[model samples]
Target: MAKVAVLGAGSWGTALSIVLADNQHEVRLWTHRTEQAKKINQTRRNDQYLDAVIPEAITAYSDLKQAIAGVTAVVFVVPTKAIREVARQVDPLISPETTIIHASKGIEPVTLKRVSQMIGEELTAFKEEEIVVLSGPSHAEEVALRQPTTVTVSSVDPDRARLTQDLFINESFRVYTSPDVLGIELGGALKNIIALGAGISDGLGYGDNAKAALMTRGLAEIARLGTSLGANPLSFLGLPGVGDLIVTCTSVHSRNWRAGNLLGKGNKLEDVLEQMGMVVEGVRTVKAAYQFAKEQQVEMPITEGIYQVLFEGKQPKDVVGQLMSRNKRQEMDDLAQLLMERYSQ
Candidate 1:
């Protein structure tokens, strides 16, 4: 088994450390807080993020240098907002040969860069080909419970992508390799916006019909934007795209959905975020996505609605009414046109 360093000790990071340990890999889980790392090392239980008993092979580290010492691979599961800061620190410590894997899902709000792009900008020690992205529908909570979970690893380097697949695959955890890194990143990041919409629909007393419409249409918009940016449109139809969309929009463990639910229940945005106590990526992604969609000339009504509700103080009911009252077009015709346009290129 190889030694792996997982940066970030949040729920997702903690859960991923558990998976690495289960696979017999020595894992150094890093958190900035010395007390938390010491506590995790002593207790073997990260009660704040997960209740699962951590395996003995997994140790927590407060020092970044110590955590990354001589590791074969480094998995970054930090929030999108923190990706740059973490990558800067890791840049000097990371070996050029070390495979950098990021599981965080979100676009940088100000720059509109994907997680991989941000890491690429900061981690000059690593080549772009050395970066891999692990993304799909697998929630941290269920994965920690040893539930059956599957994800896709994508990279410009096919060999490295396959290596990432091998690193994470096990009996309960299935991994696939893909060359469409942009699609994987876009799908994983954009789906959180739809998940928030789904939660908002639920919180507003809307039925499944509302959520289903929101999810599917929201997906169409995301695909449109992703394709415009040179991502494989078909990639979105697979794990990172449709699969992640389903899980995030429907799953109870989605923090983005929970945040939206609180917003729909008339809580202030600040209050919703404060109550979540987790990085609701959708909140930040919506801002960047909204700006990007406009720049790309892609029509994303669902994203716009969520953006307005969160940032413009538009009520949930008002947005829903506006969405329903919009001029109509054939759904299949639009989808077919998009597919044709993408495939023709």
Candidate 2:
């Protein structure tokens, strides 16, 4: 057991805190909101975000310094938009040897950088071996209740990846390690876009065939962009990519999917966001993905369609029709061509 600091009191943060405490590790959770910290400390519960279960061994702190002090590792579970801010606040307090793991999944909209890169930019004092990313199909709601889950922790250093794997792996929550940090992080971030597309399909009352098609094609777009950015293409077929997509796109727990569902049902994006009350990552990700696709010259029809619906007032039904009416192509055409090019290299 190790002393761990969870720098965020959101649903995912609380869920991860529960896991740490359940595994008999001492966990100090940090939040900017004093009232929220007080509530968690006094009642051992996080009602607004994760109301199902709370671990007694976990404590909440409003002071970032106190939360980060003397911890063996820091696990970041904050919103992607706030990661840099939080990193700035926590850097001075982090020990040089402390292992860092981030569970948040989303790219920085303005920077178009993954959370790990943002963390690196903020914490210039830490070496690359000290950072890792933990992501996969696990959702905070399900994990907080101790339901079975699995996730991946990827870092450039294989030893560091294994250490991360050991930290979170349990009978109920499994962990896998990978050295493909860029690929894993990129896959995790981009899958949310596809989940949004999946939600749109659901909202349109489209059948499983439609949803499956969105998921499959959406992955191709994700892989294409990631590979263009120097990420390993094979990582797309692994847990952080396809496995996470299956859960996010198909599961009701995904906020991105839910947001898309509302859009498909004729609700405006603004209205859906207002109703969610929490961060809907896919909305933020759409603009970043759009910019990334254009910059990388990647073809992402599903993402493009969703972007139009959200920003250009395109009808979701019309977008669906446009997709179905596109030029016919072979099933393995893209994959085979991509592999052939790789072999030529």
Winner by lDDT? 1
Highest-scoring model, TM-score: 1
Where in model 2 is the C-alpha error above 4 Å?
127-129, 336-345
Clashes of each: 0, 0
- Against the reference, the lDDT scores of all candidates come to 0.91, 0.87
Question: What C-alpha lDDT does candidate 2 achieve relative to the native structure?
Answer: 0.87
Question: Each model's RMSD to truth, in Å?
Answer: 1.1, 1.5
Model 2, 46-89: lDDT tens digits are 88988765677788999998888888889998999999999998
**TM-score of the candidate numbered 2?**
0.96
